[model samples]
Target chain A: MLRAAVEAGADAVYCGFQNATNARNFAGLNFTPKELQDGVAYAHTRGTKVLLALNSFASEGRFELWKHAAECGADCGVDAFIVADIGVASHLANQLPQQRLHLSVQAAASNPEAINFYCREFGIARAVLPRLLTITEIRNLKNEVDCEIETFVFGNHGLMVEGRCSLTNYAVGVSTNMDGACSPASHVRYERDATGGMTANLGDHVIDCFAPCDQAGYPTICKGRYRTPVREEPYYAFEEPVSINLMDMLPELIGAGVDAFKIEGRQRSRTYAGQVVGAFRKAIDAILAGQSPNPIDLIGLTEGHKQTQGAFLTKKWR
Target chain B: MSITPLAKLTLGPILFHWDAAAKCDFYARIADECPIDTVYIGEVVCSKRTPFFERHLPEVIERLERGGKTVVLSTLAEVVLPRERKMTTELCAQSDYLVEVNNGAGLGPIAGRPHRIGPTLNVYNVQSMVHLASRGADHFTLPAEIPGNVAALIGAAARPIGVGIEVQVFGRAPLALSARCFHARAHGRSKDDCRFVCEADPDGLQLSTLSGGPFLAINGIQTLSWGYVNLGAELDAMCAAGICYFRLMPHRTDMVTVAKIFFDRLAGLSSPDEAGACLSALGLGPFENGFWHGRAGHLYHTEPEH
Candidate 1:
């Protein structure tokens, strides 16, 4: 996937060790030490940077694990460490002064004060803004913050505040912030109901049910359907499963002083990531060259075959 | 055995959007009659709701202080707008009352100053706690879903730094926060034109599963557990684990009586079972204590299961 993304013209590719150190701690995903070394060597030769994601909040009495991951990532010659925890950032700033640090979106540094905190405390070179800000808010934020700003251009349009949400932890006891996995696959169960409907569950809790003709979505707690007294039928109380596609707003985001555009879904397939990256690279180049970019077809690849501009375009999304 | 049997009871800031008059009345009652030792005041959820109550803060603070309650101002849990940043900065700058920093945005201005870590900030490990403590945080309120083992470890780590650890022993656990206001959305309105729809549900609008089982509650942009978190059975265990403070999140219920019950429980005037029964008799629950047992937050683990 690193080679594919680099070849697809990604300036930087971020990945993680096969452990709880990163947010995408899915089984059969992520890299071993040798795999990371190989990926870094391959990307560096092609003028692409490899950023290590040590983004999960360290569990109590488990800071050594994150420290060890950071040491290993450094030894592997990665470009920078994308960190979320203050302890990890402080450690890197003091111990490995030369290593560049980027604040992960998992840090939820949505404001200038929060971004400045990391930049001042840990000498963070960049901060990934959470996906909750509108373009106007982003522009205002860029004026006050010292570090480079990165915003998500594509992928999951999470409704909840990053790093702060514990819906998954409340359900299955595995936390996205601490364990780096939300709605862990091990606890998810899909069962067929009597009426040819499907019920998806996380642990013993029923997250949602889909009729025979409906396409079932992942059993994330936020995307699930629930009943309320006001409505007779079950409804998506939080959000419907939709992917965020910001291709149309790329020019405005660039004008908002965004440093880089991030494409989420590290756990996705190489083919899909490469296709999306290649499409984005072309669009960005066209915009820089003062031309209207030709749109690329990515609807089929989106979750639930639906896409939304999310909270980026206007405050109406709220 | 409980190491600190006499933990202080605290009233967490009101998460719901009550009218200023209702808020003042609630606090006046709390200040005069409640046994709560510390009262956290400020808007911790939505930044838009701040203006409605900002004018009443000084009066509320004076009343609480006059009643011999230690008051702490809390910052917003999520800040994205410039005004929100300014609000956090100004809150951090105030030195009269200790501030509880809920978001990372609050940390910068309060750095090197004595403050408290609210449950919204992530302080899962000892290193994070130590680092924040070095930056002058004297106390912490763990996130609502933190399990007992992790809380015990954090409490143990906090001991050496002479910092206090607080856990929410009562309330509907705050499960998630979002930029989108579900309350307004449910009413077929956008957030900017919300018209204060959330003010209708004083205890948060309830959301149940499709099966009609209680699932979660929505209060504006924040999601809370449908079941009230009652850790009456684990109070002694928490105290033994070095937890010296218990917070009671204010709902529309009679919080004064709730605080008295918890105070009595801590003072050993009532047994755990007695306290648990009293809380149940209040009818504010279909109670849950699963997070303490390292299970689902909505589950109520029996004594045998524990």
Candidate 2:
């Protein structure tokens, strides 16, 4: 997947170890140290950068796990380390002073003061802004902070505030902040109900039930249907299963002084990564040449085959 | 021979959108009668709701101070708008009262000054706690979903550093916060023109699963558990683990009685069994302690009696 993304015109590729040190701690996913070293060599030879993500919050007795992962990444000669925990960031800054550090979006540093606090405290050179800010808010934040700003342009739309949300932890024992997974597949169960409908359950709680004709998305707590007094039928209380696609607003985001564009596809296939990256690369090149980029169609890669330009167009989304 | 100090009872900031008169009355009762030692006052959820009670703060602060209660101002949990940033900055600039920062934006302004870290801010481990403690954070309210073992680890680490640790021991546990307002969205209105509809539910709007089981509560952008977190059974254990403060989140229910219940429990006047019976009689619906027992937050696990 790293080779496919780099070959498809990605200037940078971020990967993580297959452990709890990173956020995507799923089975049969992520890279080993040997794979990372080989992938870094391949990307660097092709003039691309490889970034290692160590974004989970460190537990009390297990702080050494993150430190070990950081040392492993450094040994593999990665370009930069993306970190979320302050303890890990402080460690990296003190131990590897020459290594560049970028604040992960899991830190939820939405404003200038928060971004500046990371930069001043840990010598962060860049920050990935949380996915909640509008373009105007992003531009305003970019002017006050001292670090480069990155924004998510496409893929998984996590509507909740990152790093602070504990919905998954509430329903199940694991958490996105601590355990690096949300509604982990180990506890998710799907069964056919008596009414010819499919019901998705996380632990013992029913997330939602879909009819025969409906497409059932992943049962993330945020994108689940629930019963309420104000409505008769179960409804999407928080958000619908839709991926965020900022393809149409690329020029606006670039004009807003965004330093980088991130596509969230940590769990996707190589084909998805290649096709999406290739399309984005073409559009970005056209915009750089001062030509109006053609509208790109990548709906096949979205969740539930649905997409929305969330929060970037307006703060009224709240 | 070491003597452990008795835990202090704190009243958390009101997270709902109540009318100004009702807020004043609530604070008045808290001031005149409640046994809580510390009172946190501010709009910690939404910035728009701040103006409704802003005019009454001076009187509220005066009344609480005169009543011998320590008052702290809390910033919003989520800061996104330009005005929200400005609000947090102005909040940190004030020297008249101690501040409790709920978001990362509040850290820089209050870096060198004495402040408290609210439960909304993540302080998962001792390293994170010590990092914030080095920057003038004297007290910290750990996140709601952490188990007792993790809390004990943090509590043990905080002893020699001379900083304080707090945990939410009562009221509905906050689960998640979003950039979009679920309350307004459910009412067919956008956030820009929400018309303050959330004022209708003084406690919070109930959210249930499709099977009619009460699952959660929605307060604008904040999501909370439907079951009240009653740690009555674990108060003694937590105190033994070096926790210094017990926080009670404000609800529309009789919070004065709630504070008295916890106060009596911590004071050793009532056993865990007696306190558990009294708390259950409040009719606050179901109670849960699974988050503390290293299980799901919504599930309850009755502790074995000592």
Candidate 3:
């Protein structure tokens, strides 16, 4: 899957170590140390680059573990380190000056000053932008900053605060920024209710209950239904389950100074990864070749069978 | 015996919707009774909630100042509109009080001037801390999601620069902020037409999952934990790590008592267990300090007495 991504069109294929140091710290997924070395060799052979994700914040004495992962990544001949913690990024940049550094989306570098600071101090080559910026904002930021920009082209639309979020930890005690998993499956439980509907619970909180006819997505804190005083009726308080598909807006984003397009879901099946990556690879090539890109309907792969351009459209309602 | 405890207590900006008069009265009471050394006053969660208290802010600040408390003005957590930016810039221009930069846009105007970096800025490590300090930040409220070990490292690195460290001690943990208003959406309105719906729930609304279990709370665009975080027991450890301030987020009921409980713990007049018990009695909901202890943030792990 990742090989196809590199072969088809991705400038860098970002994955994480099989540890809690990265945000997608899931079970039976992510690359082991040995697998990471092998993956890097494989990607390099195909003229592709591999970026290691050590994006989660490191605790006090546990800094050595995250630092060790970066050192190990460099030793394995990885292309660059995708980092969130300023401490970890500084450490790796200082320890291995020749190795490239890319700011993780978790860093949430939404402005030029913040991006410039990372570029000036850490020599960051590129920054994966947060999902909150508009196209105009992205264009302005690209002009103001020196580093290349990568934006999410397809995947979960996180309308989140970025970097300061503690929703998952507050529920089940692990956070994407800290422990690398939001609403981890270990703490999540599903059960059948008296109404014969299945209820999804993250820790002690019942996130959602679905009828027999409904399709259930992963149990996450943000994508849950809840009642508030304003409505006095249950509705998605934070956001609905919507996936972002900007395949149609590729030209606009590319024209807006986007250097790369990121496809989310490192935990997805390799088959799904290869399919999406190959499609995007061909799409980008078509755009470059002055041909209309073929329509790629990824509805089956979407989280809720709904798609949005997210903040890019600038529709005040979101 | 030494009289003074190691650190000071800061009252975090009111995150809930209190009627303008009630909001002013709350701060007035804090000035009269609470032993807090600093008080932050501003609308951080929603901009629509700001106008309600705008007229009374001057009086509230004066009363807090009269009570010998160092008052600071805080910026909004998420600033997307041009009008919001203008308001924040005007607030930052006031050199009378310290400005806590909650967003990066707020930080740019106050660069090279002494200010505070709020928890929303994501100060996770020594490098970010140093970077902010170099840009004129003398104090920082570390993100609430950080584990104790990470807090300790930041504390150690910040010591040389004399930058004060503050941590959220009580009230619902603010999980995330967004530009979109969930409250408005719930009421079938856009963010601009919110119509002040948040005013009904002074402490925000409790959100239960489908099975009627406490899940999370929604206050405008901010999502918070169902449990109130009580770090009274961890005060000693945090003090040892060189933390200079402990923040207590305002709630709807018995805030004076809440402040006193924290003050007593800081002053060595009471123990953490006693404070925790007091918190339970007040019905602020279940309390958890797991994140501080480097465990699951929602789980309570009782510590052995030293």
Candidate 4:
């Protein structure tokens, strides 16, 4: 996939080590220490940079693990470490001052003041902005802060506050901020009722239900269907399972001072990532070449065959 | 006689919006009647709602100060706009007042200056706590879902500077925040023209699952626990664990009486049993302290699961 991304015109590719060191802590994904070394070698040989994600919040006895991951990642010749925890950032800034650091979107640094603090404290060169900021806000943030700004342009338009949410912690007994897994598969259950309706659950809590004719969405816990009197039909109580597609607003994003674009779903299969990566690569190239940034068809690739402009295009306050 | 516990009752910043008159009346009552040691005044949840309440702030602060309580201003949890930045910067620059920062975005203005760090800033361990302490924060409200043992560990590291640790002992523990407004989306209203509908739910609008189980509450950009987390049972141990301040997040309840119960219990006037019994009348939701016991945050554990 790294090679595929490279061949498809991706400037950088992010991957995680095969441990609790990253957010996508599924069973079969992520690289081992040896695999990380080889992956970095492969990306570098193909003229691409590899980023190591160490975005989880390090708690009481778990600080050493994050520190070790950084050392090992550096040893593996990765370009930078994407961090969120204050301790990890402070540690990396002081211990490995020469290494590059990028503030993960999980840091929730939506404003320049937060971005400035990260840059000052951790010596971070870039900050991955949260999925929350609007394009206008992004432009304002870029003017206020000195660091490079990256924003999510595709995948999982999460409605819950990332890095601060405990909905998963309240259910699955796993910390999304600390453990890096949101609604881990071990605690998930898909139950089918006699009426041919499917219910998705986190632990014992019912998240969403789908009828026979309805397309079932991923049980992300937050994006679950719910009952509310304000609305007639059973609706997505928090957010619809719509993947973000900013391709329609690429020119505006570029004009809004975005330094780079990010794609979520590192846990997905290689082919899925490569296809999305290729489409986005073409769109970005078209925009940079002073041509029309044509909207590439990506609906079939989306989670629910639906997409949203998300918080970026929406007016914030009424 | 035993030394007074000095366990202060604090009124955390209001995470909801009511009419300015309602807010002013609530604060007037707090100043005149409540036994809260400190009152956090400011709109912490949304920046747009601040204007409606800003005019009442000076008088409210005066009344609270005259009533012999400290008043702290809070910066927004999610800082995105230029106006919000200016507001946070000006608040941080004010030396006459103490500002509680809910995000790292407000840190620059308060850097090397006295301030309070709110729960949303992510102080999980001793290292993170000490790091923030070195940057001039004197007060830390451990995040809503932080377990007791972890708070104790962070508290021990806070001793050198008299950096007092605080915890939410009452009201619905705010679980998360988002840039998107779920409340507006529910009413088929856009965020820009929603007409501040959250004012209707003085506490918060309850959101339940399709199975009819109460789940979360929508408080504008904030997502709160449907269950009001009452820590009356854990107050004794929490106070003993270097937690000096107990914060009651403002909800639509008889806050003054609620303060009295916690105050009485802290002063050894009321039993934990009595305080626990008193909270039932507030008619919030179920009591849950499982987060303190290292279990799922939404569950109330009678005994340690482990």
Ordered by TM-score, highest first, the candidates read 2, 1, 4, 3
Candidate 1: docking tier:
medium
**Which tens-of-lDDT digit does each residue in B1-306 have in candidate 4?**
232455788999989988899888898899999888899989888888988988878888999999998999988888767788789878887898889999887898788997899999988877787788889988999888888888878777776668989999888888888877778878877667778988888888878887788887888878888888888777778777778789998877899999987888787777767887888876656888767777788887766222
Residues B201-302 of candidate 3 have per-residue lDDT tens digits of 777777877666666777888877778889988888888888878999999889999988888887788888898888889987688777787676676779
Could you give candidate 4's per-residue lDDT for residues A23-97 as a string of tens digits? 777778788899889989988988889999998887776678888999999899899889888888888888888
Top-scoring candidate (TM-score):
2
What is every candidate's C-alpha DockQ against the true complex, given to 2 decimals? Answer: 0.74, 0.77, 0.51, 0.62
Single out the weakest 10-residue window by summed lDDT for candidate 4 chain A: A309-318
lDDT by residue (A67-147, candidate 2, tens digit) is 888989999999999989888888899899999999999898999998999999999999999899999999988999999
True contacts kept of each: 0.75, 0.75, 0.53, 0.71
**Clashing residue pairs in candidate 3, if any?**
A60-B149, A60-B150, A173-B297
TM-score of chain B of 2: 0.97
Report, for every candidate in turn, its global Cα lDDT versus the true structure. 0.89, 0.89, 0.81, 0.83
DockQ of 3: 0.51
How far is A192's C-alpha from truth in model 4 (Å)? 0.8
Kindly give the number of clashing pairs for every candidate: 0, 0, 3, 3
Please give, for residues A144-213, the per-residue lDDT of candidate 3 as tens digits: 8889999998888887856667887777767778678877889988888787778788888888778977
- What's model 4's lDDT at B80? 69
Clashing pairs in 4: A114-B105, A317-B192, A318-B192
